[model samples]
Target: QKEVEQDPGPLSVPEGAIVSLNCTYSNSAFQYFMWYRQYSRKGPELLMYTYSSGNKEDGRFTAQVDKSSKYISLFIRDSQPSDSATYLCATLPGGTSYGKLTFGQGTILTVHP
Candidate 1:
Protein backbone atom coordinates (compact mmCIF):
# COMPACT_ATOMS: atom_id res chain seq x y z
CA GLN A 1 0.00 0.00 0.00
CA LYS A 2 1.11 3.55 -0.62
CA GLU A 3 2.40 5.45 2.37
CA VAL A 4 0.04 8.34 1.76
CA GLU A 5 -3.44 8.51 0.26
CA GLN A 6 -5.64 11.43 -0.85
CA ASP A 7 -8.93 11.64 -2.75
CA PRO A 8 -7.71 13.68 -5.71
CA GLY A 9 -11.02 15.50 -5.55
CA PRO A 10 -12.28 17.24 -8.64
CA LEU A 11 -14.31 18.97 -6.00
CA SER A 12 -16.51 21.87 -7.03
CA VAL A 13 -17.97 24.54 -4.82
CA PRO A 14 -19.83 27.79 -5.29
CA GLU A 15 -17.92 30.94 -4.62
CA GLY A 16 -17.78 31.98 -0.94
CA ALA A 17 -18.11 28.42 0.25
CA ILE A 18 -15.76 26.50 2.47
CA VAL A 19 -13.51 23.85 0.93
CA SER A 20 -12.04 20.95 2.86
CA LEU A 21 -9.37 18.50 1.72
CA ASN A 22 -7.71 15.58 3.45
CA CYS A 23 -4.95 13.00 3.29
CA THR A 24 -3.89 9.93 5.28
CA TYR A 25 -0.44 8.51 5.76
CA SER A 26 0.64 5.07 6.91
CA ASN A 27 4.14 5.85 8.06
CA SER A 28 4.29 6.77 11.70
CA ALA A 29 7.79 8.14 11.30
CA PHE A 30 6.64 10.97 9.06
CA GLN A 31 7.40 14.15 10.92
CA TYR A 32 6.81 16.83 8.33
CA PHE A 33 3.63 17.54 6.42
CA MET A 34 2.79 20.04 3.72
CA TRP A 35 0.09 21.24 1.35
CA TYR A 36 0.72 22.66 -2.08
CA ARG A 37 -1.57 24.38 -4.57
CA GLN A 38 -0.90 24.07 -8.27
CA TYR A 39 -2.57 25.80 -11.16
CA SER A 40 -2.85 23.92 -14.41
CA ARG A 41 0.43 23.68 -16.36
CA LYS A 42 2.33 25.38 -13.55
CA GLY A 43 4.42 24.29 -10.64
CA PRO A 44 2.94 23.95 -7.19
CA GLU A 45 3.45 26.57 -4.51
CA LEU A 46 3.66 25.69 -0.86
CA LEU A 47 0.51 26.58 0.97
CA MET A 48 1.20 25.09 4.41
CA TYR A 49 3.96 23.25 6.22
CA THR A 50 3.84 21.67 9.66
CA TYR A 51 6.30 19.72 11.72
CA SER A 52 4.96 16.79 13.76
CA SER A 53 1.42 17.39 15.09
CA GLY A 54 -1.00 20.26 15.60
CA ASN A 55 -2.75 22.87 13.48
CA LYS A 56 -1.65 25.90 11.53
CA GLU A 57 -3.98 28.56 10.20
CA ASP A 58 -3.28 31.37 7.76
CA GLY A 59 -5.86 33.77 6.47
CA ARG A 60 -8.62 31.77 4.81
CA PHE A 61 -6.66 28.54 5.02
CA THR A 62 -6.01 26.11 7.87
CA ALA A 63 -3.95 22.94 8.08
CA GLN A 64 -4.36 20.21 10.67
CA VAL A 65 -2.47 17.08 11.53
CA ASP A 66 -3.37 14.16 13.81
CA LYS A 67 -0.45 11.88 14.37
CA SER A 68 -2.48 9.24 16.14
CA SER A 69 -4.69 8.69 13.11
CA LYS A 70 -1.99 9.48 10.63
CA TYR A 71 -4.29 11.99 8.98
CA ILE A 72 -3.91 15.56 7.75
CA SER A 73 -6.37 18.11 6.47
CA LEU A 74 -6.60 21.51 4.83
CA PHE A 75 -9.53 23.83 5.15
CA ILE A 76 -10.26 26.89 3.05
CA ARG A 77 -12.83 29.41 4.10
CA ASP A 78 -14.71 31.70 1.72
CA SER A 79 -13.15 30.05 -1.26
CA GLN A 80 -12.92 31.93 -4.56
CA PRO A 81 -12.63 30.97 -8.21
CA SER A 82 -9.00 31.96 -8.05
CA ASP A 83 -8.70 29.06 -5.64
CA SER A 84 -9.37 26.68 -8.49
CA ALA A 85 -6.35 24.45 -8.62
CA THR A 86 -4.88 21.10 -7.66
CA TYR A 87 -4.04 20.49 -4.03
CA LEU A 88 -1.37 18.05 -3.00
CA CYS A 89 -0.60 16.62 0.44
CA ALA A 90 2.95 15.57 1.15
CA THR A 91 4.99 14.13 3.99
CA LEU A 92 8.58 13.50 4.99
CA PRO A 93 9.36 10.26 6.81
CA GLY A 94 12.40 11.84 8.45
CA GLY A 95 15.52 9.85 9.37
CA THR A 96 17.62 9.12 6.26
CA SER A 97 14.98 10.58 3.95
CA TYR A 98 16.57 14.03 4.32
CA GLY A 99 13.21 15.84 3.97
CA LYS A 100 12.30 14.21 0.68
CA LEU A 101 8.57 14.58 0.39
CA THR A 102 6.22 11.80 -0.58
CA PHE A 103 3.15 13.26 -2.24
CA GLY A 104 -0.42 12.20 -2.62
CA GLN A 105 -2.44 12.19 -5.83
CA GLY A 106 -3.42 15.81 -6.18
CA THR A 107 -7.01 16.85 -5.55
CA ILE A 108 -8.45 19.22 -8.14
CA LEU A 109 -10.75 21.93 -6.89
CA THR A 110 -12.92 24.40 -8.82
CA VAL A 111 -14.59 27.31 -7.12
CA HIS A 112 -17.38 28.47 -9.40
CA PRO A 113 -19.13 31.79 -9.66
Candidate 2:
Protein backbone atom coordinates (compact mmCIF):
# COMPACT_ATOMS: atom_id res chain seq x y z
CA GLN A 1 0.00 0.00 0.00
CA LYS A 2 1.12 3.54 -0.64
CA GLU A 3 2.21 5.35 2.47
CA VAL A 4 -0.51 7.92 2.03
CA GLU A 5 -3.59 8.25 -0.13
CA GLN A 6 -6.21 10.91 -0.81
CA ASP A 7 -8.86 11.46 -3.38
CA PRO A 8 -7.86 14.22 -5.74
CA GLY A 9 -11.28 15.80 -5.57
CA PRO A 10 -12.37 18.80 -7.50
CA LEU A 11 -15.05 19.38 -4.97
CA SER A 12 -17.27 22.33 -5.59
CA VAL A 13 -19.34 24.08 -2.97
CA PRO A 14 -21.39 27.22 -2.78
CA GLU A 15 -20.24 30.07 -0.66
CA GLY A 16 -20.68 29.38 3.05
CA ALA A 17 -20.82 25.64 2.60
CA ILE A 18 -18.80 23.49 4.90
CA VAL A 19 -16.04 21.44 3.28
CA SER A 20 -14.26 18.36 4.42
CA LEU A 21 -11.06 16.84 3.07
CA ASN A 22 -9.49 13.62 4.18
CA CYS A 23 -6.52 11.31 3.73
CA THR A 24 -5.44 7.89 4.86
CA TYR A 25 -1.98 6.54 5.48
CA SER A 26 -0.51 3.11 5.90
CA ASN A 27 2.64 3.91 7.78
CA SER A 28 2.61 3.50 11.51
CA ALA A 29 5.91 5.29 11.75
CA PHE A 30 4.37 8.58 10.82
CA GLN A 31 4.07 10.79 13.86
CA TYR A 32 3.25 14.17 12.50
CA PHE A 33 0.20 15.13 10.48
CA MET A 34 -0.18 18.32 8.52
CA TRP A 35 -2.68 20.02 6.27
CA TYR A 36 -1.65 22.46 3.58
CA ARG A 37 -3.59 24.74 1.29
CA GLN A 38 -2.13 25.78 -2.05
CA TYR A 39 -3.29 28.46 -4.38
CA SER A 40 -2.64 28.25 -8.08
CA ARG A 41 1.06 28.30 -8.90
CA LYS A 42 1.93 29.02 -5.30
CA GLY A 43 3.59 26.71 -2.87
CA PRO A 44 1.40 25.16 -0.23
CA GLU A 45 1.22 26.97 3.07
CA LEU A 46 0.89 24.90 6.18
CA LEU A 47 -2.60 25.16 7.54
CA MET A 48 -2.53 22.80 10.45
CA TYR A 49 -0.08 20.61 12.33
CA THR A 50 -0.80 17.92 14.87
CA TYR A 51 1.28 15.45 16.80
CA SER A 52 -0.17 11.95 17.03
CA SER A 53 -3.97 11.84 17.21
CA GLY A 54 -6.10 14.77 18.19
CA ASN A 55 -7.81 17.88 16.91
CA LYS A 56 -6.74 21.42 16.31
CA GLU A 57 -8.89 24.35 15.38
CA ASP A 58 -8.17 27.69 13.83
CA GLY A 59 -10.53 30.32 12.63
CA ARG A 60 -12.81 28.71 10.03
CA PHE A 61 -10.71 25.54 9.98
CA THR A 62 -10.49 22.42 12.08
CA ALA A 63 -8.10 19.50 11.67
CA GLN A 64 -8.50 16.04 13.10
CA VAL A 65 -6.03 13.19 13.33
CA ASP A 66 -6.68 9.58 14.18
CA LYS A 67 -3.50 7.59 14.47
CA SER A 68 -5.23 4.30 15.10
CA SER A 69 -6.91 4.29 11.70
CA LYS A 70 -4.24 6.38 10.05
CA TYR A 71 -6.77 8.95 9.01
CA ILE A 72 -6.63 12.72 9.01
CA SER A 73 -9.16 15.36 8.10
CA LEU A 74 -9.61 19.07 7.59
CA PHE A 75 -12.90 20.84 7.84
CA ILE A 76 -13.60 24.32 6.59
CA ARG A 77 -16.56 26.14 8.03
CA ASP A 78 -18.26 28.99 6.22
CA SER A 79 -16.49 28.47 2.95
CA GLN A 80 -15.69 31.33 0.64
CA PRO A 81 -14.52 31.59 -2.95
CA SER A 82 -11.20 32.86 -1.66
CA ASP A 83 -10.91 29.54 0.11
CA SER A 84 -10.71 27.73 -3.18
CA ALA A 85 -7.47 25.81 -3.32
CA THR A 86 -5.90 22.43 -3.24
CA TYR A 87 -5.74 20.67 0.07
CA LEU A 88 -2.87 18.31 0.76
CA CYS A 89 -2.27 15.97 3.63
CA ALA A 90 1.28 15.25 4.72
CA THR A 91 3.07 13.12 7.23
CA LEU A 92 6.55 12.83 8.63
CA PRO A 93 8.39 10.22 10.54
CA GLY A 94 8.83 10.87 14.18
CA GLY A 95 12.11 11.88 15.82
CA THR A 96 14.96 12.57 13.37
CA SER A 97 12.89 12.31 10.21
CA TYR A 98 10.31 14.82 11.29
CA GLY A 99 11.48 17.50 8.89
CA LYS A 100 10.94 15.49 5.74
CA LEU A 101 7.30 15.12 4.73
CA THR A 102 5.50 12.64 2.52
CA PHE A 103 2.43 14.06 0.84
CA GLY A 104 -0.84 12.71 -0.48
CA GLN A 105 -2.23 13.63 -3.87
CA GLY A 106 -4.00 16.89 -3.21
CA THR A 107 -7.74 17.47 -3.43
CA ILE A 108 -8.88 20.48 -5.38
CA LEU A 109 -11.65 22.52 -3.82
CA THR A 110 -13.64 25.30 -5.42
CA VAL A 111 -15.90 27.54 -3.42
CA HIS A 112 -18.13 29.38 -5.79
CA PRO A 113 -19.48 32.80 -5.04
> What lDDT score belongs to each candidate, Candidate 1 first?
0.94, 0.94
How big is the positional error of residue 45 in model 1, measured in Å on the Cα after superposition?
0.8
Instruction: Let me know the TM-score candidate 2 reaches against the reference structure.
Output: 0.96
Model 2 agreement with the true structure over 10-75: per-residue lDDT tens digits: 899999999999999998989899999999999999999998999999999999999888899999
- Pairs clashing within candidate 2: none
* Model 2 misplacement above 4 A: none
**Model 1, poorest ten-residue lDDT window?**
92-101
Q: Write one digit per residue (lDDT tens) for candidate 1, span 1-113.
A: 88999998689999999999999999998999999999999998999999889999999999999999999999999999999999999999766547578999989999999
